[model samples]
Target: MSLFDTYIAVDWSGGNDRGAKPKRDAIWACAAGEEPVYLRNRQVAEDWLAARLEAEAGRRVCVGFDFPFGYPAGFAEHLTGREDALALWDWFEARIVDAPDVNNRFDIAGEINARVSGVGPFWFNGLKREVNHLPRKGLDRTNADFPEKRLVEMRAKGSFTCWQMAGAGSVGSQVMMGLPVLARLRRKYGAKVWPFEALDSAVAFVEIWPSLLAPSFPGGMIKDAAQVRAVARAMAVMDGQGSLELALAKGEGSGAEGWILGVGAEDLLEAAMKPIDMPRPPKLRDDCFALPAGVDWTPVDEALARLDAALRCVVGVEQVSHTQVVGRVVAEPVTARRSNPPAPNSAVDGYGFAHDATGEGDQVLPLLAGRAAAGGAYGGTVPHGSAIRVLTGAVLPDGVDTVVLEEDCSVTDTHVAFRGPVRPRANTRKAGEDVVAGSDVFAKGHMLRAQDAGLLAALGVDALPVFKRLRVGVLSTGDELVDPSQNAPPDRTYDANRPMLLQLAAAWNFEAVDLGHVRDDRAALKARLDEAVGQCDVILTSGGASAGDEDHVSALLREQGNLQAWRIALKPGRPLALALWQGVPVFGLPGNPVAAFVCALIFARPACLKLAGAAFAEPQGFMVPAAFEKRKKPGRREYLRARMGSDGVEVFASEGSGRISGLSWSDGMVELPDGAMDIARGDLVRYLPYGSFGL
Candidate 1:
């Protein structure tokens, strides 16, 4: 069966009435397999739509509207005191005054602009008289409070901004006037709006772009009429082919700004009316971290891009107590079970009374017998002209809308007296003020912190789904190295890389597994890797990662696994061998202690976090004036060990990769761009603290 029995498309408009004749720049609607019809105005359009929906009861139907369903992210919360699009619809429906030939949309727009900023986010009034706050041209408005375009508009190329009101391509006025009608229909018919709500309802509304598909128009047909008809027919055809469900897939921010159906599925929509050969989906690869071919001496940014595109979370999820979830990556979004504070409560130790009891001058009120304290609230309603003593966190008794702080009152055994002019609902916290019940508190892939634990407890979330810790196996290679605990020969050195890497992995909240040290023999390295694949989700090896003859780490990977020895254009570290052995990812790091540390921080850390089921996030860096002067050549990025000093950021004296002391000498790193430049003492440079990299 098809997803929908009927499909409807509407070309919406916001301007004043244009007589009874069918024309452009007016509302028009078309149902699949039916003729396009002209709508005189919004009132008639709403009536006709309601009648159609009533007649189509019990049959699955989908309606597409041309105007935007919502504004940018913060606009709803700023104007309506709620972050929901439907709430904004109700807000507009309550305030907007619409009639057959005239409306107060421009005035309402001006009022909204006055609330946000006097200049305008909503502009271009078409009225003959100048409208205050609403500018006549886009150039006169300063839209600094919010974004000019919604997130969906940015992705859909050639789409007009939803901020302009009277311009040729403006959709702002249409949204202001049209959302109210849709809101009424949705409430009356129980129809679900796509993305904002689930699309399981018999009647569903979706955002649509008529220009998304190019269809042949019948001769002498108006462009708006032809567009509506074409879009409706295309949607119906796609539904019959069982491909319309794919077009309704939800994306990021779709719930907030709404997505245009078929915007991302242009090819499928174009081929809906024709028979075509569909290519078979490619086979899934077992090796996910395999680098692309011909990638040689890649730039640092390019290498990061490749890694971000290739990696996916490889761990399984389990339910853990909120108490133990710190440092764990969330596998599912956690919604609040109850609101913070749970009920209206006093914000200070004070006397609570109804605001209307006292006015004009100093008034005296008699005290109630009982007092409301934390965990012990007064049972009865607070009578007018009477005050009840209440402490912070104590639930406000009925009939009490205001609280006068005890410090501001002269209290005796029988009565409490305070000054006049107490604000309504003063010194009292409203229920759901901090967090509302059923609202999303944390999204999937969020790494929990200690503060998150307190929030979870407050929200009554006892347990949550979290990904299992990634098991990272650390293995150090080289015949000249021995464990620090062991007696080493004069020619041998201690295996510092293994201990350092293992500790770093643990510090990053991963399960660090000691794979021990392996010599430069190919057979020994192969045995160690074969064992590591089963015990670890990822294997990290230092030394023997280069293309040298004794580079058994690279040799074994090239011979047995999918290996790509990426020579990155970065100072201190260059050779980075990424491979997959037996479906487990492996990171081959440098032999030098300094290079291994830098490469691990800059490259391996983010990749590992993603693989451990955490969301992809770049380490934040801040710009600071440089304390030292240096002239750097182009082609490779340089990172100098740095620390914040009195002048600005001070770098270590040397840039040698073998100087392991430099790593410990500084608290952070200063990064230089790839282009050649002369950095003076006063010049600004990007600095990244160790904490920013999850140190």
Candidate 2:
């Protein structure tokens, strides 16, 4: 039996209307076991597809559309700070406007081209649309951010540039209108869009270059319906022979950049073609870590840069009351609702006078007719050379520009004699000095503290828009592990990594969820992950990450999601596993408690902060003298648990990662550089305190 109940091939149109019969300006759809359908517009096609998909409920349905699912990978990263092809679909869906005969595909293409450095990437505007930015000629203009063609487009001989919207053979218009339909289908049917997301899903929607398959049919058949029918029939035959599955397996591209469904079956196609050289690795890998052989292990700095580029902030914002916003990160810029002090007020309990008192000789001024106290002010302007009795924080009377402290002046009931010289506006608080009206008090991504809350409250702000706390699920997996409260056999020990990680998460202002422990059974680990993925923004687990015979976490992830990267060049923590399970990020640390602690501090903590929409955090470290001699390898960087003493920083007696007591015994850690070296006593070493990592 075929893997899917039906196979569909669609030839899309860029034109604005349902052209006359036999014209190529209408959508043509052909399904296995059914005749080809010529749809007049996008809405009609979408309604038709939705009904077909609903009729095939509980069965796998495979659909292929003729258009670029995503643009060139570099353009994607430059626009979205990510290279995932699926993200491009969302980007287009948000920007492109598709109406039956009045779409703005050409205009949007011109707008996107303007963002890049050069012109002509998106040339060839439609006849009616006058896009000033889009140039007609000079299509050879170079932009460093975008490639000339996507990988699949270059691989297929007859493919056109998705950037060209108006010219003949241009796929740009089709892409702009097609992606929104694909996004809607994905939302309604949960269809797996290939090369942008993965192909492990049941109901799959893939990108197809109809020209790649159009050559197999008889020549001189110019009808669009005949082309789609021939391609659909050919795909059904391929499905019967199990060639379709092989094609899907071979078409996997860097995530969400699309690959043609039949690129892998170039040999089977009638056209005599040489293999097109796919672009060199774009300095990024979406499916897995590029642990190429003969390459040295990644340095700590390079690893951190890669991690930052690969991750994105979790979505969604929350309205938090000012009183309860402490420890929350701001999701939007916070503006001051009102100026501090609101009006001109006295900076001290003193006498206010209208004079440049700091002149050569002290000017004796008469007392003002009224007194201005806090919560009660003197309304009228002060007479010339007259002083007003003003208390601290009271609004200063008009015409009085300076204040002289009561002690600085010899005072009497009728008048006051100023002895010390004073400058204009001295000791007078100006309106809006502390906080100007409509000024941004706090920017987005600022983590709220006690003082921040107090400042917001003073501005009369009762609520703030803050990112919701990242809920981290912590777990420990091992067959020989038991709960801390339960007794264990001599061969087994209590679970410590979970509690430590949970506490660390809480300390770092995350919502920590203890997922309990699971044995090394594959089924058991899978069950725990299924439970945690929905509740947590990210999952952290200790043990079972290594490629041991009984290790199940890595194995389960391989089956359910994807294992992106594993292992880092850092001592005390090396067997680190990074994966995605049901779209939730998972960070797997070593089983050893000490290693788990170090990894949590170095990796998981920063990852959590990013997910919570906070900025990158690098714990500050200082250089201190090495108090004890130590030897280390050359390649991987190492951290030694140590305490500061009279001489300098002292290393822990033992180097084992399982030595949990060493963490508490030492005040912080001493970092050693990569390369084989000997640390002599009194040698300078970089030191980081536990507090620096937000202990």
Residue pairs with colliding backbones in model 2 are 85-256, 196-256, 289-564, 368-387, 634-675, 634-676
Cα distance off (Å), candidate 2, residue 358: 7.5
Q: Please, what are the lDDT tens digits per residue for candidate 2 over residues 562-624? A: 774456789988877888776778988888999999888888887778778887777889998
Candidate 1 regions off by >4 Å? 1-293
Model 2 is weakest, by summed lDDT over 10 consecutive residues, at: 272-281
Q: In model 1, what is the error at residue 665, expressed in angstroms?
A: 0.8
Prediction 2 global C-alpha lDDT: 0.76
lDDT, each prediction: 0.85, 0.76
Clashes of each: 0, 6
Q: Work out the TM-score per prediction.
A: 0.59, 0.57
